[model samples]
Target: MNSLPPLRQPCPPGTCTCRRDELLEEPGADLRILRLTRHEEQRLLERLENIRSLADLERLQQRMYEQLGIRLSVSPSHNEVRSMRGIVIDFVEQPGLCRKTRQAIPAAIRRGLERQPEIAYRLLDAHDLLRDA
Candidate 1:
């Protein structure tokens, strides 16, 4: 009588093992916190696509700060089995925050995700230094 919904209600076939597998957002949860102009996002994606190594990621991190006033972090994936790694971007400037931004950023929402051996720019959600305060 756990009476709890599955990770994914009506889970997709083959993804759930009746243990702990599938997960999904509620019916109407728009998790996209921040958004960039189409051109800005496209430019970011282009740089992400160029990440061929960790060094590249580091450079991108720097670039994100200088270009877009956003802090970006890249790290190796702990999951050896997975093909890629991860990156974390917090819009704040505290403990885990990035201390630099080359531009004056307007208020907005933002989030960060991870990268692998190759760079893949993925935005889970977004926050900000001022926003969080």
Candidate 2:
């Protein structure tokens, strides 16, 4: 009779099933082995720099809306605006939008404007204020 090696226990719920030894044995096992080009690195750095703080992120969102006719809502309350920046970043990273950030923006703005013209007008007003400043 042939004897079998010990069987490993299953992973906990929601955990990956692959064993650490199995993963390590694979060539180029890490996802980040595919590296970014110099330009891609620079762009990533720029994006990171752009969102250093809530105020900076808010300005960025407003600029996107103003320049590209994309209407995104920032909260009326200052505290809410700070919290919403993280949400905005997540929204921008969502997949299946044709990889054209500018393209989806205008449509988003249009939809928001249709639902809440006052918000759109407020964004425009903020743009004017920034321009004057």
Candidate 3:
């Protein structure tokens, strides 16, 4: 069983802020705080539409690194990382790949690759390159 102390919020003159932690602790609380503004949301949606495959993923990663300097990569699962890297390398060696073949890459990574193209791509590429022989 998980137990945490009740949260206490800073009090203003005759006013109290809700304890965010306590609220989050409640079962089935669906509270979400939006971190991005409207423009950011629109940009993210647009970027997501452009990602297609491993090359696109790479490009997106590079774009992110240049723009925001955040690095994204695959988890440290040996087999999955190796497989993804192979796909990326294959795409690199051969350009003008068919859309059907490109579709084989995972959609989640594709979307991520789109959102912050540069950084995510570099991190993923580096991870793929360094994890194995």
Q: What is the C-alpha lDDT of each candidate?
A: 0.34, 0.39, 0.42
List the candidate numbers ranked by TM-score, top first: 1, 3, 2
Residue-by-residue lDDT tens digits, candidate 3, 1-133: 9974332222343332334345456776423321223354346446645656556655765764354332344433444544333223222311122233234333545455545556454655666745556
Task: Put the candidates in lDDT order, highest first.
Answer: 3, 2, 1
Q: Which is the winner by TM-score between candidate 2 and candidate 3?
A: 3
Q: Report the lDDT of model 3 for residue 20.
A: 37
Candidate 3's displacement at residue 111, Å, is 5.8
TM-score of each: 0.35, 0.25, 0.31
Looking at model 2, residue 120 earns an lDDT score of 40
Which residue pairs in candidate 2 have backbone atoms (N, alpha carbon, C) closer than 3 angstroms, thus clashing?
71-109
Error of 2 at 17 (Å): 36
In order, how many clashes per candidate?
10, 1, 11
What lDDT would candidate 3 get against the real structure?
0.42
Q: Residues 63-104, candidate 1, lDDT per residue (tens digit)? A: 666644455443333332242223323343312111111111
Candidate 1: C-alpha lDDT = 0.34
Quote the lDDT for 53 in model 2: 42
